[model samples]
Target: MCSHYEAVNKPERLKQAFQVAMPEGAKADVWPGYTGLFIRRPKEPPQEEGVAPWREAMVGSFGLIPHWAKDTTVCKRTYNARSETVATKPSYRDAWRLGRRCIIPAEAFYEPDWRSGRAVPTRIARSDGQPMGIAGIWTGWRAPDGTIIRSMSMLTVNADEHPLMRNFHRQEDEKRMVVILEETDYDSWLDERNAEPRTLLKQFDPARLTASV
Candidate 1:
């Protein structure tokens, strides 16, 4: 699963890609606890309804801690929710059922290849070096004082047999990668579409993708 990634790193890049500004002070490199941006429909009424209509950009906790969780500690293990079981997983089910979809932007994400019995850090990015619009889910958590703390989690798919992805992770574990959405398909992914979003879970073309250790 993706535990770390680098964002586009420039305000102009974000505006060009998503028509949204990078939040002030948001870190370019993201980890479990790092603050980063996510795109989702605003909850307020008169909601924008097009493919990307009414989307709002917010800086939130990267690892999801369900809105109703008793504490934030649960976020440590909920960073990446498996697409196949996301709708049924305890930590992610509610958000899935309620349409808490989002996009996590990243320039590159890191994984480890254990082909040589050691953790080797590898970076995955588009051959063009543009930012990847990663599919994700988000929700708002309430603090003790009634303030809301938003958080999000990346959606991942099994990649055990993938030509590029299979090289990562320990040999004994299942290989998985975050679902990266094409910019043109952003609206479909954000809205309720075709009843099965899994249909959009295509693995990136390793040919157009570059990976380096």
Candidate 2:
């Protein structure tokens, strides 16, 4: 699972790489070179007639609470969702089915490995240097005092035979990588009309994605 990412370029660079509209009033958080789109659930009331389009929001470094949780600490354990069982896991099932569908824009992510007991960090990005869309889920949780806390988590799947990730992943433990979406599948994945897990899962194609460490 990706724990760090870098988007050192301007938002315009991300726009060009993803070919998507640039987010308005965007700000940069450079500690980890964080840029690109990070999404959260809207605080507005749910529409009675139709589903509202996913809204964007900036989240803190380590906070991701589910809507129904009594406390926010659960989020710490939920930074990443395992693809093999996310659809059935108690923490992610509801969000995966109906509540949360989001895209995390990223340029490159960092992976660390223990090489001879030393932590060696590696940067992973596309060879072409295109922006990538990581699949995620979000929720809107209400606090006791009526404050609504929005949170999100990234989804991960068995890693492909990508040479870059092999060094970080274990041979026996199913290798895991973030779920990346293609241009054509973005709409369908975000469309509330098609929230079925099967339909969403089919949109991911490992062949179009390339990584370098």
Q: For this target, which candidate reaches the highest lDDT against the unseen true structure?
A: 1
Error of 1 at 93 (Å): 0.7
Model 1, runs deviating above 4 Å:
44-53
Top model number, TM-score = 1
Native RMSD of candidate 1 (Å): 2.8
Worst 10 residues of 1 by lDDT: 44-53
TM-score of each: 0.91, 0.72
- Model 2 C-alpha RMSD vs. true structure (Å) is 5.6
- Model 1 per-residue lDDT at 130: 82
lDDT for model 1 comes to: 0.83
Compose the digit string of candidate 2's lDDT tens values, residues 1-213: 766666324645654444333444333432322223554444553343333334333443233466667787786677688867877888888877784677677776776654446557776665565766777776667889998766667787665564445556444455567777775666666666674644454323444545443
- lDDT of candidate 1 over 63-140, digit per residue (tens): 887877897777778889999999998899998898889998899999998989899999999899788999999888
As for candidate 1, its clashing pairs are: 51-187
lDDT of 1 at 28: 89
